[model samples]
Target: MILVEGIGPLATIQDLGRPGWFDSGVGVAGAADCGSLRLANRLVGNPEGAAAIEVLLGGLVLRALRHHTMAVTGAPAPATVDGMPVGAASLLELEAGQTLRLGLAETGLRSYVAVRGGIDVAPVLGSRSRDTMSGIGPEPLRPGDRLPIGPVPPAIPIVDVAPVATSTDEILTVRALLGPRDDWFTDATALFDGEWAVSTDIDRIGARLDRRSGPPLERRIRDELRTEGMALGSIQVPPSGQPVVFLADHPITGGYPVIGVVVDADVDAVAQARPGRIVRFRPAG
Candidate 1:
């Protein structure tokens, strides 16, 4: 068992996510950065989709009730065990009664911690992921919460440390395919030409973007469109013209027109982006 000592801004248990629930009005709410979560799980010898703790902007502290193998990944949060510093993306051995604390993330917006055995939380919709938008799954972790660990898996971890990009100030470029409503825009190329800054209004649902200069995307068709299905990474443009890139907990459908869709691989980078980070779009080949 692991005891939650401190919960910083937000912390939640997550797995790969509950898929196939969109038709039922449920969004697949997993780790915002699924690749980082998978990497943490791999370091702990757990399945890639095993349940783990997703820490937002770090500051999560956990105490082990028993011996456990653990790993921290993503965001490069400073970690320590009983006051001794530990490295991220590497295996950590925690003895009984030992405490692990994670400081504020040096870069990126979220960090992940995985134990040898996944967090044994009750599953809702066949997943342990917490959907902040729908109030589904377990509640956000709080201080003094005791989390049970699952039985250890047979697979053994081979790598001591895994290589991962920490974070960078370089403007992030994401590829998108102009889409179903591209014709509605006065100039679809505007999305690719203009530079955008990530807005402060980011969450598990989506990250809003504001153009650095020039007018936002203008609509040629002022007519109200019927609500349509929305997918992860769907770049929806509202009447205000600013684009919002849907994330893990995005709504199943939206009324706003989708100008384009970011590719899946690049969505991970989008999730890690912090407020004020510059982002540029490029046409997907």
Candidate 2:
């Protein structure tokens, strides 16, 4: 078991996600930066889909109740065990009563902390991921909460330190395929021509982008469209013309027409982009 000593902006237990519930009106809620969480789990010799703590903007503190192997990945948040510095993407050992602390993220918006056996939180809908939009799974972690660890896996860790590319660039490129509704826009090419700034309204549901230096995405069709199913990474544009790229907790359906769908592999880049950071879209093919 481990105790949450302190928490920062946001922290929640997450695994790969609860998929296949979309038709039932459930979004696949999980770590925003899924790649980072997977890497953290792998480094600690756990399955890639093992549940871990997703820390937003860092500043999460945990106290160990038993000996455990751990790893921190994503955003390169400065981490320390009992005040001694520890590197992200490297194996860490926490003895009973030892305290682990994470500082503010250096670049990205979220971080993942994975233990060897994973967090043994009770699963809801076949997953341990917390859905902020639908209130599924566990609530956001709070200080003083005690988390149980799962039984140790038979397989041992093969690597101690792994090099990972952290989110450090202020301007990021995200690739997407145009048009399930590109024709609705006056000029869908503007999405690739303009550099959009990540807005402060970002959350697990979506990342809204502000037109930093270009015209807003003007839609030719002003008539309201019937509600349609929305997918993860759908770049939905509302009447305001600003685009919102759906994320892990995005709604199952939306009224707005989607101009594009962000590439599945590139969604992590969108998730990690900090407020005011620039994002430039590119054609997928």
Query: Whole-model lDDT, candidate 2?
Result: 0.93
Per-residue C-alpha lDDT of model 1 across residues 1-285, encoded as one tens digit per residue: 999999899999999899998879998889999999999999999999999999999999999999999999978899999999998899999999999999998778999999999999999999999999999999999998999999999999999999877545579999999988999999988999869999999999999999996556989999999999998999999988889999998999999999999999999899999999999999998
What TM-score does structure 1 among the candidates reach? 0.98
C-alpha TM-score for every candidate: 0.98, 0.98
Cα lDDT, model 1, residue 49: 99
Residue-level lDDT tens digits of model 2 in 1-285: 999989999999999899998878888888899999999998998999999999999999999999999999988799999999998899999999999999998888899999999999899999999999999999999999999999999879999999986544778999999979999999998999869999999999999999987767898999999999999999999988889999999999999999999999999988988899999999997
Candidate 2 at 12: error in angstroms? 0.4
lDDT scores of the candidates, listed in order: 0.93, 0.93
Please give the RMSD of candidate 1 to the true structure: 0.9
